[model samples]
Target: MKKLEDSAKRGRPDIVHFALMEALSTPLFLGNKMRVYVHTINDRIIAISDNLRIPKSYFRFEGLMMNLFRDRSVKSDEGTVLMELADGTFTDLLGSIGAGKVIGLSTAGVRSTAEKVAGISRDVENCAFVVGGFPRGHFAQSTTRLLGPVYSISNVGLEAHVVIARLVYECEKLLQEGVDHEGDKERGKIGA
Candidate 1:
């Protein structure tokens, strides 16, 4: 929370708060265990990992997030506050996650077709999909360089929340269909 607030304060604006709430509330992300990383305006990254239950009510959420940002420690009625990574940049976060593929969501990137994007799930175990938190513009140069592929889910620019919801839903569906399992089986047969 502190990390989010600090990032929002530095220059990102309130868009970060809304994006965080939307992503946390989505069924794809809520039902599955996933980690969310917030890259603040000041180049600091805040990671929310493990069991994360964001508030449903906007007012309660705003208050809780604000409090967390200010105090750096606060109990939430909605969910447990897990670990936080401080003083880190987007690049640092990616590096710590190892050499996994990093996909950045961007307007100028390749269009996502059903056929081409379906393979996304196969890389889920070792990929990070990043959505910009700011209202406008592109990701920083440092962050862009770290990305393996940049994709635009919509022809027109969509809000951060919409992009995240759609991406997560598609990825989760592919995961449910056992894309990884099928690939592994094929690999074993080939090896044998």
Candidate 2:
């Protein structure tokens, strides 16, 4: 593993990484983990990762945030709105297997999808520990270093199998493409 620089400024940065409640049985934190994916007024997604050691207030906040999304309490232009989804909810639907704590905010005024992805990338730049690119329910249990948004996962229960299968196929295809490209380049080269 490469050394990741610390993004936390002084007071342990609001975002943290810790094991999820669901990972107790499994070797990894999966689905059972929960976190707050706060989207600030600036259009940033911030994942707050608090564990058993963290204050209960953090969990309260997590619960409240999840409720907001569940009840559709999202108010437009609320100037720093925070959104959340329980890890269990994700697992119930998308089968989220991990989580992390960090916020991905957009400086743009809710304009384009490109802007959103850019904001996510910017968050990754500020924090290098980000892996996979999406807020993962399982990864949240690992470290306090802010991570990236996890890749998209299907929410439908049985549909997850399709997503998983597609991901595997893509990974295999990419690996094959990489190997073929390398071989094509090397095959033409004459070594002394």
Candidate 1's TM-score reads 0.75
Regions more than 4 Å wrong, model 1: 1-13, 73-80, 83-85, 179-192
Q: Per-residue lDDT for 1-192 in model 1, tens only?
A: 446543433454456667777777766667664567776656665666555566666677677667657766454367566535367777777877663678878898898853355366465666777888776568777778888888887789998887777777676777666766677778894342
Reference-based lDDT, each prediction: 0.68, 0.32
CA RMSD of each candidate after superposition:
5.6, 18.2
Tens digit per residue, CA lDDT, model 2, 79-143: 34333333332223212323332332222112233223323433232222122222222222332
What is the alpha-carbon lDDT of model 1 when measured against the actual structure?
Answer: 0.68
Candidate 2 colliding pairs, count? 34
lDDT score, candidate 2: 0.32
